[model samples]
Target: QIRASVSDKDLDMYEKWNQDYGSWDIIEKKKKRVLIGAASVGIHHAIFSPSGDKVVTMFKDNEIAVWSFETFYCLYKISIDVGIEAFPSDQESIDVDITLPISQSKFQLMQQPLCFSSDGTLLVIVSIVDSSLFVWKWNEQSLHQQIDIPLFKEANGFNTPIKQAKFIGNTKLIGIVSSIGLFIIVDAETGKLVYKMPKTVLFDFVEFSKDGKFLSGVPSEDPKTIKLMNLKDFIKKKLLNYLRNFGEFPEKYRILIWRFLLRLPENRQPFQSLCDKGLHPAFEKINRKYPIKSYQMIKTLERVLSCLGHWSPLFAECDYFPSFVFPFIYAWPILQTFFASHFSSDEWAVLMDHIISEDPSFIYYLTVAYIRYHRETFLNMKTIQEFNKFHEQSIPTNVKMLLKSAKKIQTSTPTEIDIPKDIIEPFKPIPRSPSAYPLFSNYPVKIVHFQKKVRDKIRREELDFLQRKKVLHELSQLHQDIETDERKWIDYDNKVSTMMDEFWDKLIKDENDHQEKVSKINALETEQRTKLLKNIQKVRQNLVHQSDAFLNKQKDWEFKLDTARASLRETKIVGHEELQKLIDEENEILK
Candidate 1:
């Protein structure tokens, strides 16, 4: 059974979430819904009865409403106004059984409602602005008024608010822890203070054992350590009655029973206001004063969103995930205090950087595990729009779970178990000491003195051995550094040599290329010269043939001229012989 409260000026509502934990179908079918509504004022605090059949809600305006668990309806309203007259002291008959009609007129309850007792028969409320406690007996429907008990006195310098008040089991004795570190037990029936135990450190909470045999508390200064104190007759009796069956109970079962008996908070709050308002401002102060190394924190924030985005479609598309450091800073107020008190800014930054470098996902798992553990508190939230509101709310119950999961995620393996060896030997009794020859047996005092000297020498030798070990360790480290430096130098040399070889090969190739070009140029020049010479020879031969043709033509013309002349002479001779032979041929004929 879970109860959720909502309040306004006109209407105040209480919603009950009920489920049968044993039913499989109920869980599988999502058969969990908020049951509607009850009327109350602005309830500052409220709690269900031990039987879960009734709920009592306290309003800030000093109105107490009792609602029935079954029908979500208000059973009674006690408007105890502040500064109202106390219950009539002479009225003894109205202590236990109050007839509803007679005491109805005194129903002006002028205090902030606190809580109901475990049996649901008593209603404890406190004044709105003072340290006055009002206890009332719920006799059926009528609330019989009781006397007001002042938790603080005027002798004290200032008023101390009651930090926590709860009934010890089903009894009428209530245990209260004040703001000033006072743990007191009061009787709820008569509003009388029973016992007071002054504490050195102000505790956040005070709790009682189930059987009312012991009371335990967690100090506000050091909430990690829980201290238990004996109560009532149990203090005198010690553990006599409890220890009688201790041997008979199995060790495993005993731990479980002991845990059940002592019902206490697993962890204390990181700070007084971490679970409430002012957390953000305090974180802002820390951020300004001792800023964390945000490089890794930012990386982790990215990784967390990326990891969650894989599973949730909304996260995959959403731009922002929650701040990973907010929960840690809230949960580790001591760390903040230490940083502020002891560490310099640079030192703290380096420390934070180291932590982030080692494991950036540490805070991621812690925040996720905390949210997962107390997911019910976030049921009203749906989207990133509601994250601002969700971050402001506190879930103290998940602190332990968050730490456990974070540690588990960070650790690699379990520590080695220390197994003890048996003292007895397998074959014979162990010798106590090793003795030498009886050189000094005759002189007892000398032997004792010699033994002392030997012991002193042995001590000296041990000290020398330790010194040598330290020196050797330092030398080994130096040697390692030297070897590392040598390896680096060797690598550098090899790289330089390889570069030189490449440069030399390139230079050789360039030189060979220059020579090859020069040879090609010379060969081309020689070929051109040979072609020029061949062309000159061909021109000479053509000129010679033309000259010869011209000379032959001239000779032929000369010969033809001679033949014509001779022919003319022959004709002339024939004419002259026939008249002295044609003259030129006539010359030939005459010759």
Candidate 2:
């Protein structure tokens, strides 16, 4: 029989299947599964376990069921308890008409919220609505850990909905990405967030390689290109960015940051185990060697020193270990006391009398600057005794100038005087025998190492200070030159402005004179045209009178010609009889 199942166009399983006579048949006769008691109505998603022996189904009613694939029977059921309180209050006030469809689509396009580890030992689930994460031990079917996304308090309690989560290779660590681009790694067992990233625009999906060496994701801002980050490099760059952005951790966060830098685990059980071991033998001389007025402070110091001694054998051998840890306990009193095994109480008092600012933090800077001031003299001394002797002799002479320079250095910008790495890291003294340097065997090796570090730091600071001074001097000179040039440019600009004003005034006058001449020429031309038109009209009238008189004269001549013709015809008719009379008449006409 073939096993088959049917789903709607959206691939949401609505029916179960059963084998029937070499073919699969719908168990509910094409009807949707009915909700009965606590039973789930329909399967929204399903996935098979790595061993293919079991399957997990996410149902329509915020529930998941584990089923034996071969037996086809429900094994366990889990209800996803993402209550309304898990969602941000602001989300509820959002206009449904504006954001309903968009929010719905985001959920629809999101990946499956549940995943199994590579070995199938642990199962991880995330809620689409609130981004609440849950880790479960698959075999025991028990919840291991649960936490909200973006656990860092710095996230300011904002809801960053998780987009995808998966196990990193075969490790017990789970990596998750949020819609707002918060990438975090959490320990599956403890549920502690191990790594957190600053917010960025992240695409809908992110994944780790099979070996979990690299994590790759598409950025929403640059969707066409995929970014790959090496796990080690990503963490290193993140730490560097943190330090660069916030130059110094606040006072409250100092200890936590120190623990992080030192890679100290926060597990309480281990620290308690060390504390239970009692005080180290080396610190038995605490009451005699470094007398403290407060009994509680002494007890605290002993307990802490004992823990350190128990953690490392080297700490047990170092006689000056208590002094090294003293400042962290009673900060101000420790600064006032000089327990270096060399300086007398009288000499320390004399040095303190000259100093004005007794602030512990400033004194620390002052001590560093003091060591720097006496660097050359200390270097010339071949033995620790000679060094201590010089330190005593030099204190009274230059105490005032040293305090002034120390205050200046203390107030200097962080960039101008870097807080050295050696200063930030906890001091670890090298193991050395008393016979190695017999001249100063009473001096703790810790102080010698500290002096060397101070000298090195002072050398670097001196060079930096000189370079900065030179730059400032150059900048001052350049500023003066720029001022001089600006003055000359202002004068030149004023002169040019005056010249341009005169030129414009002359040009305006010339244009006015030229326009006046053109106006006069136009007026004269108009007058000439009027006179010429009048003369032409007078000539035309005389021509018309002459032509009329000539026409009348021509008409009279034609009439005279016609009468002469008629007289000639009459004379020819009576030619013979009247010949004599005509001859006389002709003679009269001729006369």
Candidate 3:
């Protein structure tokens, strides 16, 4: 379920844009105003710079324009060969989820909009008609969000136009990564294909699951299937259900069963062979002798084990190593399922010992995964020799015993399979060693200060908010006073007009009588006008003084910004000088 929606979809436009807002270029936010240049036909994308100060637009004419709105300036321009359909990459860019269906032939690539990541890390240009896709990377110096047009094939349900775009952080971005009916999810922040998921429409949109475990979409193959997951979720959910027959075993007791199921590779030859042999007829004899109906369990195991046999055929090392590494890298419950079955304490110890000794790489991450995934187990076994032996370079006797058990794990088929020999040669012998490998934290407290600067800006905005409110209040009061003054002047003008009309009407009837009074009235009016002019001048002078005070405050703020830049320059100079001195010392030491 979508938890939130994007705000501010309408880009600010002026004048002629009252109708053709789409024609405006990328709108950039600087302070209060929005800056935009022509985007050829319409503004397909609008992006704020990393600082949210400048904006760049990709135009339909294949021209890129830059704008700084706070200054009301068009700063720079770069030309592109591709048309105006560029994608915006700011973190706040819209996250679209599309499960809607559209015709593949109608999907035009030339008009499909491009996408960039929210943090300004990657740029993407999508073409629905040509079925071409491009991915550009950010590498600091040149080509910030460059595009590499991807070649794609045209087909029916297989290939369709892409319609949406999104980022899964920096390394992996999902959604419509390509045309030809594909919702590509490359590696997180990087361009590595984890799995290709299905989409509903030719332009079906894809997004990351909140937890980042699965990539789900409104399905193409099945309309009702809005959620699709990897083999892992499939198994987990299958185990989760209260089924007709999980073959036997309570839901609570099925964890170890699932773990064992995961350990069984995509292709299970042993299971297939068992189903072919039909449950070891020996189990039937044992059931008759013991009255335990263990044959039923054997049959269930046979079918489950046989299920993997028909899966994709596996080649040698190259094909399967990545598969093996994935489970270990991501600790799928390999041990949990194995132990879920009723097992003796000796058996449990033996399994643990074997995993640590023979599967050192697996064991290292297992213990780490345990600490990560199974917090309780990690806390309880925190001091266990098995987990700590990597640093100690010593294995306990129990570890050796477990290795023996793993080695002895066998099938009824015939030949003894050596676990070490079966595994790839490179991983056959992971040495026991004591070494201090530097540990790297997932999220470093020290970022490059870019994000920190954004936070500081937010804080500054909060501080300025009250100041802005005060300024607004002052302006409102000024506007109300000006309106009141206009009303008083209008009333005074009306009274003078009434008096003049009465005098004009009286003059026609009695010109002689009115001459003396009119002269005296005119003189008095002249004096009153002089006094009113003087008072108006004084009020204007007071307004001017207040205006100067407001302007002075603004100038002071600008000056502070200027001084801050100077201080920044001074700090950089000192740091540079120190670096130079250190270099000189190092040179002398080398001599």
Candidate 1 lDDT by residue in tens digits, 284-402: 22334334567565344434344333323333222222333333223232132212222333333333332332234454454455566667857867788686544444324433344
- Would you give me the overall lDDT of model 3? 0.44
Ranking of all predicted structures according to lDDT, beginning with the best and ending with the worst = 2, 1, 3
Ranked by TM-score from best down, the candidates are 2, 3, 1
| Candidate 1 local Cα displacement, residue 123, angstroms | 2.0
Model 3 Cα lDDT, one tens digit per residue, 325-370: 3222222322223331223434443344334224333443333333
Candidate 1 TM-score versus the reference: 0.30
lDDT of 3 at 441: 27
Question: What C-alpha lDDT values do all the predictions have?
Answer: 0.50, 0.59, 0.44
lDDT, candidate 2, 163-234, per-residue tens: 778888667778887775667887677776667766553555677888666888887778788988776455
RMSD of each candidate relative to the true structure: 30.4, 27.3, 46.9
Choose the strongest candidate by lDDT.
2
